[model samples]
Target: MKPLYRGLASATRRKASRFALETRLDAMTTRLKDVGEFGLIERIRRLLPGAPDVDVIVGIGDDVAVLETGGGSYLLATCDCQVEGVHFLWDTTTPFELGRKAAAVNLSDIAAMGGAPRWALVSLMAPQEILVESIEELYRGLGGALAEAGAVVVGGNTAKSSEGLIVDITLLGRVAPEHLLTRSGARPGDVAAVTGTLGDARAGLELWLRPESGVPEEEARTVKRRYTSPQARLLEGQCLGRCGAVHAMLDVSDGLLSDLRHMCEASGVGVELEVERVPVSPALPAVAAALKADALAWALTGGEDYELLFAVSEKDFPRVADQLLQETGTTCRAIGRFVDRDQGLRLILEDGRRSSFDAYAGGWDHFKAT
Candidate 1:
């Protein structure tokens, strides 16, 4: 007992000494809140910038890291995590739904790369008092989602979380060299398009948050399903890859505008989205109306749609969109066009007015004040 006390005391002293050192260096170091998530990513990228001169295929900035393995296919790897309070609440979310969502988000990353998912590693952290049966059901949901795309959960690690449940999954996939689309491939004049519709998932989230908004039960179900079970556009992505038409691509996990910003920055271009053309889900208007919200605003900044946002040459876009629809029974809409780097990101409103979109604002930031 004395030794244990001594060990704790030493640890406390070490922490205090480190705290003092940090205090001295405080002015030089910015807080996490100030940096935000993307800012921190930029800092980390600088510390370990991928090799120059084609040594690195795809580096830290994109959705999935692409690796060359001396084969016809490039390996795709991506991981995503969902926290209890930050991402969801047990009051509304089921363990099964949470598990399914966690897997689907990772699959969306692979889908963005136009890859076929093969394997997954799911790591989880839960409260010690969480029911073992609940964990089993969670795995059931996760495994079923993965299985739909021919992916299997091969292995994972488990830990006891102090507060909320956390599920992190690393998905592995492969894509043919010819079909491996990336965000950096977008070119000026490329017609930017998105698969399926937007705003539904965000509307679903709104319904959950504003239960008394009086949205009809059937309409609520439609939007809520979109939030809980996002179809990752895997088939549409594969079709686009095979068509040899898509120049660049990504999943709309971070809202159309924000993800478009990422693509523009990566491809060294600007864009102008036709606001009137942005596709809104059929159910979104009713939900937005019921909640007394601006439906257009929700579609613009609402993240987690998980639909595919892509670019193709204007001449090729029609054929590509048609092929995707015929092959996967999924539709796509061209809402924007890439432009000269100097133009920046702008939007054409219904009134024929053009305005610059401030990409850094009105989007989800993990560290930003909600």
Candidate 2:
């Protein structure tokens, strides 16, 4: 009887110890919202085993992971995911538009690396109640967008989700070794330029959210088109790479200021942005006025523009800009210049006053709690 009691007591103690350990783990486990998307990515990167191979030219940090194929060219791979409620509203955009956007976003990353998109794989998550016709329309849009970029849908997967829809696309591209642009090549005095205008998409989103915002019909349509169907600057990026002038390049999917900061950080440099030099579509100002918001603010912090943001040597900027404009018929503007790291990121006002760029910290963080 004594031995039996001792055995039971020991078993109880083991159960208690296990429960305490689990409790402690629950307490120590950090929520993803607290860490944010970038922080979570950093943590995951730290957890990943180190790869010392030279074939992995760029990994984890940049827009795309560049791999040396030893075939005189480098391969670029990138992927992007879009959530239904988070990235778009069902009422605001159709399934077709969402599919196109998912593909375009991934292609934009490939373009940012000065590569031409060749193939894509799309994975989708949807509810069982989702209409089959809607899914077909979505595929049609995806097919069209890929065809435009000369990319094909090679393979993908589908799963039923309990919640909102999810579309993820992985794109593969190629770039010449000499023309492989990255975010680490910018230097002090390099001119920062962007292809096409900014803020139109943000303004369009605002209008979509606030239909009664009194935006003109024509202007609203134009801005909404910009949002629903963003054109990736694929040709422009290839031209920039071939021109031998672009130092570093990235796409403006994360807002101009945020993406520019990414370039500066990777290059260990800073930036001085001329606020007035930032380009905006003709429709953005009216939309801003109707919403009583700053047009420049949208241009600075709004994401999903998908334009090319690149740095070029000051001497080569004019020739590069001219050539790009001539070749693509896209408006290219030099909105800023790189500075030394100690100088810090800044924004120059119209009155010739410079201020620390504290007004806008970042664009979109996926793990942020609303």
| Candidate models: Cα lDDT each | 0.88, 0.89
- Local accuracy of candidate 1 as per-residue lDDT tens digits, 1-370: 1335444554465444676788787877777888899999999988984557363578788989998876678889999999999888886678898888988999999999999999999989889899999899899989999999999999988876769899999999999989999988899999999988899999998888888889999999999899887878898888988899888999988888889989999899999999899998878999999999888887888999999999899999989988988999998999989999999899998999898897325567788655
266-326, model 2: which lDDT tens digit per residue?
Answer: 9999999999999999999999999999999899988899999999999999899889988
Backbone clash tally for model 1? 0
- The C-alpha stretches of model 1 lying farther than 4 A from their native spots are 1-28, 49-55
TM-score of each: 0.92, 0.92
Residue 50 of model 2: what lDDT? 92
RMSD of each: 3.4, 7.4
Top candidate by lDDT: 2
Q: For all candidates, what are the clash counts?
A: 0, 0
Give candidate 2 misplaced runs (Cα > 4 Å): 1-25
